[model samples]
Target: MTAFQPDLSSALAGSACLGAWAHDPASDRIALSPVLARLLAVPAEAATGTSLTLALAAVEAEDAVRVAGVLRAAGEDGRPFEAEFRTRPGPDGARWLRLMGRCGRDPATGAVTTQGLAFDLTEGRRPVGSDAQQAQRQVNRLADHAAAMKGLVAGLRNPPLARLVDEVAVEVGHELARHLRGGGRQVH
Candidate 1:
């Protein structure tokens, strides 16, 4: 079983940042949070009972096949699945969504049900014009430079420079993490 991220516990518990769903294939009924309905762009009234066709239609065309495969395998094989895909949530360009769920069967009737949580990854995916994105770009450049330096340092066997480079790399990694965590200001 995939362990739930502790950082998501509060959000999932309150259905704030996360959406949860239970899909019943036998009855063709799906019980989902309002957030899920909103994410799928499905009407609140259409969230349950055979209206999944419309909801699934909201998924990006290229990603729909993978989504269907994961769901189908989960229902038939009782496996857990995780998928990340871009979705056209509105007129705005595509947004990223991460889905994590498990499937199970009724012992008596062999009915398959899949339950899972959804998280909006759009913000992270669309950092295009943000300070964090700029910082990330800088970090990427630093990483590439550091990799080249590592090769030179290894060849020259300069222990002191190698140690300094290692320390700098560690600091760069911390800075990158801070930027990703929304610490918008540059680290030194």
Candidate 2:
């Protein structure tokens, strides 16, 4: 029997609120998935060969320095990193994104690369008010859960099971983000 091969393009297309990215330390270049490119307000075509500075140009001024520092530290230490920052207002208006990833060396090329996922948190954010703080807390919890799930999946030896778990975690995160964005109202 032939092994199952999942169509990554279809999977990525279905995940509108999630994006993946990889950065090469030596070249200071970043490769963003189409969804990530859109979320970051970068053109999809341009994102594939974008420089790290260019990709990060979308980060809001307030968060740019801190995010850059985090990335620099991660690259230096080869550690996992998590950062939440906002993008400048574009056609889609300002968006909040949570990025989680780790730095590692590529065995074949002996180059260091940072890879991770970007989750759109804007939809789940409540407007400024008493509820806003609570909403932020909820968003943080969801991000924490996703990071924890990633760690768990990394430990799993079965590729199919790992992929299934990761997908479920992402779907659940999207549902929760949507619910928070809707002010916690019951759908039905």
Cα lDDT of model 1 by residue, 1-188, tens digit: 13464555664655435667777755545666787677777788876644445667778887877876677677777777788787765764566887789898779987789888887776654457767666677777677777766775877778999999888877777777776777756565
Mind giving the per-residue lDDT tens digits that candidate 2 earns over 1-188? 12477676676455433777888776777888787787676777888878777788888886977877777777889989899899998888888888889999989988898888877878667466566667656766777777777787887688997888788677757756765676565333
For model 1 the TM-score comes to 0.57
User: Which regions of candidate 1 are displaced past 4 Å?
Assistant: 1-16, 26-29, 89-93, 107-110, 128-188
Clashes of 2: 0
Cα lDDT, model 1, residue 178:
72
- Score every model by TM-score: 0.57, 0.60
Which residue pairs of candidate 2 clash?
A: none
- Quote the lDDT for 85 in model 1: 80
Which lDDT values do the candidates have, in the order given?
Answer: 0.72, 0.77
TM-score of 2: 0.60
